[model samples]
Target: MSPLDQLFSNYLPVFLGTGIGAILVISALVGSRLLAPYSEERNKGTTYECGMLPIRRASTNVGMRFYLYAILFIVFDVEAVFIFPWALSYLAVGPQAYWEMVVFVGILAVGLAYAWKKGALRWQ
Candidate 1:
């Protein structure tokens, strides 16, 4: 068989399975919409927050600082997560892996230092 045929033979089952799954999901969504009861109640369209009646408009101005803090937390948190798997296999990976991780950490440290210098870490 040719290379394309070999490739298809190897992954044909996976492609078929994925196609079947997509078809089933689409059918289920369409079936639910067609078979389920439709409601036209006005209250159903209203904004509900924590089971309490909304007092004012939902779109309110929020401080950019909150988003900055969240993004910084995510970046550092993801970096911390990479350390765990590296630590587990460090012995096998040896000195190369160690130096790579050190470089990665140093880059993150520079980013943190820059943020600190710019007062992004300040709560204000």
Candidate 2:
């Protein structure tokens, strides 16, 4: 077979799949637009807050400390997740896996130390 024919044969399935996916998405969107209900009530566009009328605008300032605490929590949470599986299987894997996990925990410890020194752990 010619190179052009071979290339077309290899890509034919991909092209067909993409075309079919696009058609399906477009048809779904068009069908939703045609069949969905339309509303013009005054309260329809108002802000909703737990079934109660919103008392104020939603936008507000959030302290950077909140984000820092969230990041630290996520980091340690992931560390725990990794450590659990390794703790269960480390005996079978031997000393190399143990040392690798030690290094991983060491890196995380250094990060925690740096964050502590920078006062990221401080609440006030």
Candidate 3:
């Protein structure tokens, strides 16, 4: 068989599944919009927050600390993702894999310690 045909045959189930999923999602969305009731009540269109009408524009300045905390969380979260696969196969891969993970985690630990010392974890 040709390589092109062989490749498609191998991935036929994946392609069919993806196409079916896309169709199902699109149909559900279109069906909901078509079948759902349309209403034009006066209060229904207004934004409600904490059962109180909004007095001003919703846009507000966020603190820089919030972004710093978020970035730190993302960095550590990605580190943990790499560690998971290494841990699952650590036994078969032996000491070299174990030491590699240790160095990876140790570097992160140092960074965490630095952040702690700098008061990044503190919320005020």
Tell me which of candidates 2 and 3 scores higher on lDDT. Answer: 2
Global lDDT of model 2: 0.95
Question: In candidate 2, which residue pairs clash?
Answer: none
Q: Kindly list the per-residue Cα lDDT of model 2 for residues 18-123, writing each as its tens digit.
A: 9999999999999999999887999889787778988777778788899999999999999999999999999999999999999999999999999999999999
Error of 3 at 114 (Å): 0.9
- What lDDT would each prediction earn against the true structure? 0.93, 0.95, 0.91
TM-score per candidate: 0.53, 0.52, 0.62
Query: Candidate 3's residue-wise lDDT over 1-124, tens digit each?
Result: 9999999899999989999999999999999999999888988877879889888777788898999889999999999899888879999989999998899999999999999999988887
TM for candidate 3 is: 0.62
Q: Report the candidate with higher lDDT, 1 versus 2.
A: 2
Roughly what TM-score does model 1 have, to 2 decimal places? 0.53
Clashes within 3 Å, all models in order: 0, 0, 0
